[model samples]
Structure formats: C-alpha cells, structure tokens
Target: MKKRSLLFPALLCASLTTPSYAMLNGCVDTTDADKKTAVYFANGILTSPYAAENMAFKMGIAYKNQFKNLHEDSSYEFSDAYNYSQGKLTDIAQVLQQKMDEEGVAGISGYQIYELISSGLNNDPIRAVLAAFLSTTTNAIYTDALLEELGELMTSASVEAIADSLMVNSEHIGLYEANLIAGKRVLIMPHSQGNLFTNNAVAAVKTRQPDWADSIDYFGIANPAALTVGGAGYVTADDDRVIGILSLMENVLASNLDNDPSALPSFFGGDSRSNTNHLIVEDYWDARLASRAVIDTNMLRLAQNTPFPLQIAGTGAIRASLSWGGQPDVDLHAYEPNGRHVYYRSKTGDDGILDVDDTSGFGPENYTVACESVNAGTYQIGVNYFRGNATETAKVTVFLGDGRTITPRELMLNQAEGSYGNDNPATMFEITVTDDGEGNAIYSVQ
Candidate 1:
C-alpha cells in the first residue's frame, strides 16, 4: 500500500491536552496528537467501561507512538501509511520487532485488557493494522485471555462455541487451564478470578493429563482484589484453573464494592461460580511472601561469588508449594564488626516456607524472614537443600541488614509453577516490597 500523503509538518502540529494514566488498555494520552492523527477519545465499542476504554486507547496510542519514534523519521500524517515507500513500512516493522525484543515479556498479566483491546482490533482492519505493528511475539496466556474476552463480546453462541472448542481439544491448554497458566506466566491478572481460573485450569488439565498437572507452574496475580471472596467467585465461575495472589494491601485496602468510594465493580466483574477447584490458592501469597522472607534483616547475605555487594529486598514471605520437596534451609551471613559471621540459619523444622492454610492477614507468615545481623557490611544468603549441602543448589538472596530495614536479594526456585509469580519473577519483587511499605503499593490490571 502507498503511504498516505503527509500534511506539512507545520499543519500537522496538533495538541491533545489530557492527562493520561494506566487504563484497561495499559496506555493513555499524556499529550496531543498530530493533525493527521487526532488524539480523540475512542470508546472501543464500550466493551470495557468508558474510563477503561479511554485509558486503553490512550495507552495503545502511546505504545504505537513510542514504537514509531524509535524508528527513523517516524512522523505521522492524517492519511494512512499505504502511500509511503515499502522501505518506510519495513522500517516500521523492524522498529516494532526491536520493541518486542526489548519490552515484550513471556509471562505477564497486566496486558489482559490490552490484549482484549487488540483482539477487538482483530476484527477491525485499522485496529488490526496497529495491533500487528505492535505485537511481534505474543505471550500465549495473555493472548488467550484477550481471545476469551473477545469471544464473550461476540454472540452468546460464540462464547459457547469457544468453550466447546476448549472442552474437546486435548492439545490446547483447556480454556480454564490455559487462562490460569497464562496468569502464572504473566503477573498482571492478579485477581481472584485469575487465580480461580488458574486452579480450575489445573484441575481440568489433571482430568486430561494428570501427569502434566504437577509440571504446571502457577504465576501469582499482580492485583490483590483478584483473590477476594467475590473476585474468587467470579474467576472460579469464569475459569478456575488459575489462582490469584493476595497481598497485605488487598487485605487492608480491598473494600466491599457496595461501600468503597474508589471501588469500581465493573473493573472487578467477571464470571461468577459458587464451587471452585480445591487445588490451592496460595500462589500469590507465595510470590509475595517469598519476596517478603528475603527482607528479614537476619535473612540478608552476600553471595560468595559476586564482587560487588548486591542488596536484596522482598515483598513478603512466599507461601510454600506442596510440590516443593521440603522446607528450604538457608544459611545467613553478614559482615559483622570483625570477621564474617553466620548470623542465623533456617531452623530444622522451622522451614521458612509458609503453609497453604496460613491466614491471609498480616501476621507471622505475612512478611516472615530469618536474618543474621552482621556488624554492618555486605552479605548473601545461600539456601541449601536437605542433607545435600555439597553445593548451594540455589542462591535465594543477597542483602545487608543493619537493624534499619530487612531486604533480601535472591530467590531460587526448584521449578517453574503456574500462577507462582507475575509473568516476570523479577518484577514480582516489587509486589513483595510494596506489600509491606506504605502508600498505593497495589495497582489494577487493565
């Protein structure tokens, strides 16, 4: 297609004076647009609420613009790009590819709303053009959520058709499990619905392939509201294979939809079910707690291998996995006044892992940690498995605890689990940090 004719740069100068924040689409308009590309509000057929839709459009626009700017001479024209040279279009595609290489992650759930918006565009030629430009390698979990939400937007028959397709296709992750597994990969869908869906998906998978069920990894929810009684019910009814992660913030800030002024029920609405999978709902807790456990001043340590001291802090103690071999025993070390000190170690039975039945409140298990106070220096925490202390299987953390704050640096996992942490285990560290800190530690998934 020929690139659309470009208006003079002077004529293209148009501004959109609006504030932009994270919306359901994960994009927003912070400034104005060019004459060719107007920065106007797009309701996106009202699938998401106006606030959410507006947010998504703005975010999408921002993402597109960001990608464009990274390319050479990425100026916009009022008309489409068909009028431009093949060279220009190729450049645009290359730029998008570079972006995916840099920013696109394998497992993350924040883009759920964005994925839904992209799926919506799948039906629209213009929208599809933009989405294709942005997506180079798609995360299967995220893509599935968007697809399912889009299916719901389609006729009722369409939703049932998709469900039936999932029920029959043994190869595909069951709709329930696929969604939950996606949650495990991406931490953005951190809600009860996401968690419930993950758990249900696991159950569904077990029914078909019990052997693989153990292999399934669980990613935690980025949002705490996803695990509430209501949120759990919604996701369970919608998709029970996935599990949601809960944080102190959710336990503290989550309010009844009827009473909270800031609460947006529409944002929380989803498939509702009374019965739910009984696998376990501690992925989020584990994600948060594992990170939290690192924060204990006593748990801090410096790896013996590293040259520079790495400071590590976590959000909370991670809920232990039943699949986990046993409670991890760790050796804590720090630079005390004179010589290297063995501050504290994971007690024999006092394995640091929180049990599945622990209360969701902020208590012993919430941000549990075992730290060794060195005089004041750098250190690392090395975790050793049962009697096999031959070599450190995993270096769980490296940190410095000086009686002021507890910070853990590393987390070594035995194997990847579904809904275990947000898409990125590294990013999930933030959730661990915020769970105990003051302020708006929690965010909503678009």
Candidate 2:
C-alpha cells in the first residue's frame, strides 16, 4: 500500500492560536491521595512543541473528571514530549510575523503565513529576507530544510527516544518510590502515531531493562499499530479519521478488499478485521474513557504477567470461565444439581468438568458442563480465592448452550475474610437447566 502524503504540511499551516487555558491546565480533584503516573504520547498532528503538552493537559482533565465519576480515588502524574523542530519553527514564527507586518499583510491567518513562505521561496527578494532570518535563527538554507528535519525527527530515531524518555524520566523513577511507599502503578497512554512510537519504545525498553517490563501497563487509543496484541489494551473509534486511514492502508496492503480503490469511502470507515484485544468505541473520547475503565479495573492484573482471559461458548455445551488479575489464586467452583461439586480437588462431576485449574498469577480457570450431562435443576457458579491475596477482582463469564453469552460479571473479593476451603464462595451467576423434548438439556440464566 502506498503511504499517504505527510499531513504536517496542513497541520503546520492550519493554526497558531494557543489552545484554551482550560484545555491546557492539569486536573487537581481526584479520589485517591496516593497518586499514580501516566505517560501520554500525542497524536501525529501534534508537530508543535507545545502540542503534546496541550494534549496531555486536556487528557489529565478528562481523566480527573472521569475517575471522579467512577469514584476512583487515584490520580495520574502525566509526562509527554516536545518536538524540537517544531519548537524552532515556533521561534521563527516571530520573525515571519515581523516580516508580514513590514509587508503590510495585516490580519494574515496562520495558513497565510505558510503561503507567504512558500511563495517567497521562488522570489529572490522575498527569499533573501527569509534566508537572512533562517541564517540568524535555525541555520537552515530554505523552508524545505526545516521541514525535512522535522519529518526526520518524527519518522526516525528521535521517535524512539521520545518513547524511551517517558520510562527513564523523573516520573518513572518516582513510580518506584510511589510503588514502594504507596503501592501505585504506572499507565502508559499513547494516541494515534504515539501508539506506534510507544510500541517501539516498549520493545526497546524490554531489551534494555527486561525486569521493568511487568511494572508498566499500556493503553493505546486510536492506535495504528499493525501487530498490536500482547501486553497492552487498545481502543479505537469507528469514526476516527486516523483509524479510517489506517483501515484503508491495512486493506490496501493486505489486498483483502476490492481492487477498485475509488470505491473506498473517504472517512468514517471500519476496521476490516476485528481484534479481540482492541476495543471499538464511538469516538476518541469514548475510546479514552473505555480504555481508562479497563486500566482502572485491571490495574493490579495488568502489572503482572497474566494474559487477558478469552471466553468462547461452543454449541451444545455450557462453559464458564473465571479469570482475575493480580497475585490471587482464584478458583472456579460449579455446584451441580446432583449434589456433586466440581472444583480443583474434584475436577470432574457427572454434569461437567473443571478443565483448567490455575493456581497462580492471572487465571483463566475454566469449567465446562456438557448440555446432555446437565440435570433439570438450578446450577450454581462461583469463585473462591483458594490462596494468595484475597482483595482482587474476579471476572465470571457464562456461556449458554444456545450460543448466547451472558455479559461478563465482575466480583470484588472481601480481602479480610476470603481464604481457602471457603465453601461460601461469592455467587456470580446461576444457571437453570431443563430437558428439551429429546432429553437434551437447555440452559437459561436465573
């Protein structure tokens, strides 16, 4: 697939007005006093030095408000990047504004300034003025030189440095202190192109500090990364322009769609393939809040090496998968109507079997009961923290034999009272079974 033209030309020329102060201020109100950290990477259009800062500030505000709504007490410490080339261009804007004033080009918008520069490049007299200013400031011969450097910085080595610096910075170091003192975690958030940059940065970090890999979590929004699957959660909107473009590029590269390129819609497209790891939302803001919820709910699980649980309900079978994050050794307990209890000790009963028993780390302990083996009575499904820490969130998903899936239910364990051999495990969902005409059991949620 052909790469789209660089978007910086339009973004750089579009606006110069500073973002609103409300959008650039850090959020103060939070639920938790022991603050966590967030390292954010701005989108591709944030070519200006202050753009990342502005984006981060706005995100901080959104997070604060959203977390407050969710009643989460914890707060985030934000870190971001400043584009050096964009900084130089912002400095040169002052000179360009003075020249515009001398030429009596009053009320010229930001785009008009770039237009003047583009036009001046061909006229000797105008070029002389720009050249003089460039020599005094950036030591560049022409406008193209600055653009080329900016493109290089955005597309090459500096991109990785931008991602790496987030981890090695004072905020990251502070994470260690906070973790030791207050048991806090770090969340790495990147939007759009920053997602790609973050993917590379994480790869680099794994090579450098292999041990710190489990200490951080990643939440990518509007991501363009092609092979994003492990160790991160991704959220993308159906109407996001960047996601649309990326979807187009992906289709083109894979040749999965029709060859007629003209048939493709310009915007508001959908991803060709559904990624289980990526959550699809309505828009950018939705993606942000959804990713935040995932992070907030699974912060303890994400900091450990536990794979996100996968639940699939097969025809003619009822399955229940119990999973949790953190160091809790959670167990799945299914009570059948025939007085048989299926658990780790008694893996199989007449109705079903506890197929997998995970005793450590992130668990996807599974219980499967054949529809034919089920009796016509109510079945109870619950989870027990057999060992380890008790105060962890447990996810229970019930799959009916009719190919319908119950929404995964989450239960917070009472850390104080939870322990092994606790028969009174928290009930997550109840399943009732009745015999269809031919002795085949049918299932329904009770």
Candidate 3:
C-alpha cells in the first residue's frame, strides 16, 4: 500500500459538515493511556461569566508552559469549566478601600474587615459564612422557605441543604457519571469557589465507587472551605487579604493553605482586588512570582503517584460500552474505518478492541479507545443480543473524549424480532472522524 497523504496541504472537501462540537467515533480497545490528561474546570461567574473560567484555565496553561519550559509537555491535554467568586472581590475591595481612606494601608486589619462583614450580617459571623455559601450556591439551591429557616447557628438543616447544594449539583453528577464512571484518570483542578465544588464531587465518587477514589486526583487553589472536603493538597496566596478576613473564622476558610512563600505582600490594604493579589491568575497560578507554581508542582506530583483505574473502560480518548436492562447477555460491536471489525471473535481491532465481554446482568462491558489514539475514520457501533432476556433494553454509551461529550443511545431488543447474531445487530449509532488540517481530529455523530 502506498503512503497516505498527511492531512496537510489545505485539503478541501465540498461535502464536509461544519466541524460539529457533536462529533466522534468511539472505538473500544484495551489498556491505559500513556498520554495523561486531566480536566481543569474553569467556569464563568455571574458578572463576567468567562472571567473565572479563563482564570482557572490559566492555571493549566501556566503549568503546561512550565512543563514546556522543561521539555516535558509532549503528552498532556488541557480543558476547562470553573465558576468564580469575584463578587467577593468587589466586597473586599470596597471594604479595604474605605479602611485605607480612613487610615493608611498600614492601618488596615483583616479582623476589621471581618467586623464590617459581621456588622453587615447583624453581628452573626456565622451569617457571613452562610452568606458566602449562598453566594456560590444560589444558582443551584435557593428558596424563600429555606431563607426563613436560617439562624445564627449553622444548624443541621443548613448543613443538609448545603450538602444538597453540593452533592446534587448537575456539574458534579456529570463529572462522576461521565468521566470517573467511565474509568478515566482525571485531576479536577478547582480554584477559589470552585474548590468547594471539587471537594463535594470527590466525596460523591468515594461514596458511590470507592474503588475509583484513588484514580481521581485533585489540586485546589484559594480554597474558602474550613478544610478540604477531600484530603487533596490546596494553596492560597500569602497576602490574599480577602481570605485573611475569612481565616479569622474557622468555619469559613481553610486558613492553613494561606502560607505561600512565593506570594508577595499586597500592594493595597487588602489583596482582594481583581486583577491583582487576590485573583487566581495573578496571585496563585503564576510561576515566577507566586505560590501557584508550588501548587501546580505538588499537583503534578500527586497525579504521578495517582494510580490508574484497575477497571476497564475507565481510560480512553473515546469509548463505547454496553449495559442492559434485563438479563445476562448483550454484546457491543465497533466497526473501525480501517476495515477492522471489533466484536467477540476478534476482540482487538486495528484501532480499538473489546476489553470486556459480560454474560452477567447489568454489565458495564466496555470498549475503550486504545490509549493515546482515536484513529481518523467512520465507526458503525451496534449491539447484539447473545442470550437471556430478549425483551430487555440495551444501552450504548459513547464517551467522546478530546473535548467531545458523552451520548448514550438505547434500543429495545425484542427477541421476537430476531435481532440476534453477527450480521443482524441493532445499529445504535454512527460516528465519523476526519482531520481538520491542523492535526486536530474533527468528529461527527449520526
């Protein structure tokens, strides 16, 4: 066979679909990925929805740049979605500015700011903590009835509601059911308000699938929690004066993370001002002038020691697996573009393989994409009824890695319809892959 042209040279295709965010063919294969990548969640805040996410994403880019500087950045991929607490910045800045105007910056005290916040909350410091919690959680869980139930004490009802705000969060559920449940190794990098979210996400994983707990790595920045919900290491800048105020109260922030040798003293009375000492990008993630370098270094170390999933389907660039409603038998099949067929007889294909073949009930029999590679091509994914309950519904979950999302399709296998065997498998879906001429894979699903 002659060599295929590298997708360079500005290739043109008249019939091409607009690069769909909804693309990808998931080939099922075996093994762990050598090219390790972690999901760095950087989300938008209420005021500037993209700002916090950008700041959070900067941490990864900063770390990646450091790795690039040392020539060790060949194998990692970066991604984002994180919410920010910039409103705290506004509050802190306003308070600190007022204090500095009354007395010089040197006269400002964290305890003073804490007093102002406490006074605003009717002298209940616990109300300040609850206010902080409500700031981030308002979008998720909020009700007038709940508000009426509030008091100076952080009571059992408030704790339960806060837990509901965290554990029942949609984003947290997505991370668990999608990536972690699929068996991927991930480092959930969350900063500031995001640390609270990540901590709760870690707890949900531990409760549901403790076996996968070690596979999930975490690194926190500017945590405002009393302590980490997960035992992962975290960091905060030395002169992050907003937290300086919160540190005076044990229930509000993780004061222990405030010690950063690299962080400089604040230029202002308090370091909570945006684009300055309190920001995640400027104060925490930057390498040459901040503690975030140490934070990133330790996270990388933690990821290095973090064990890979002992289970299959937990690792992949793309994946497809079978789970059925009723009895003990359903089969997943993938037809890779290179004419390689992946099924029971030939488990391994040129691109991916069938690593799991279950004859038991409610199986997560998975076909993970071969580590580090999801070849360019069309994949026809289908399923067959091998034995047992014929009236069962079979589900095929396609985890499209590389910035793609997960899609699960189900088909009711009526045994009377004769939908069993090699050639007669039900076609769950199809995915097409092509190069976008810039070394990036463009995927589309049918």
Query: Each candidate's TM vs. the true structure?
Result: 0.20, 0.36, 0.50
Off by over 4 Å in 2: 1-316, 416-421
Off by over 4 Å in 1: 1-189, 192-324, 327-337, 343-376, 385-446
Candidate 2: residue pairs that collide: 31-73, 32-73, 32-74
Candidate 2 per-residue lDDT, tens place, 54-140, comes to: 666765665655543332344444545322233433423322332333233335432343454445333434334434433343443
> Which 10-residue window in model 1 sums to the lowest lDDT?
76-85
Query: Residue 59, candidate 1: how far off, in angstroms?
Result: 21
Q: Tens digit of lDDT per residue, candidate 1, span 1-446?
A: 11111221111131122222211111112121221111111111112234433433433443345433533432221101011112332322322222232233343222332344445544444334334423344423347568555434432332232333222222122222222221211111113222333433334454543323333333222222223221222112112222112122123123222211222333554212223221212321121222223211111111111111111112122211111112333222211112121222212112122211111110111112222111111111222122222222222211112111112222344433323221112211211111113222222110
Give the Å error, residue 391, model 3: 18
lDDT-wise, the better of 1 and 3 is 3
Query: If candidate 1 were superposed on the true structure by all CA atoms, what would the RMSD be?
Result: 25.4
Q: Which candidate number has the best lDDT?
A: 3
Q: By lDDT, highest first, what's the ranking?
A: 3, 2, 1
lDDT of 1: 0.24
| Residue 365 displacement in candidate 3 (angstroms) | 4.6
Tens-digit per-residue lDDT, 87-161, candidate 3: 543323322222222233345433343444435545345444344423354524645455445442223323333
Query: Which candidate would rank higher by lDDT, 1 or 2?
Result: 2
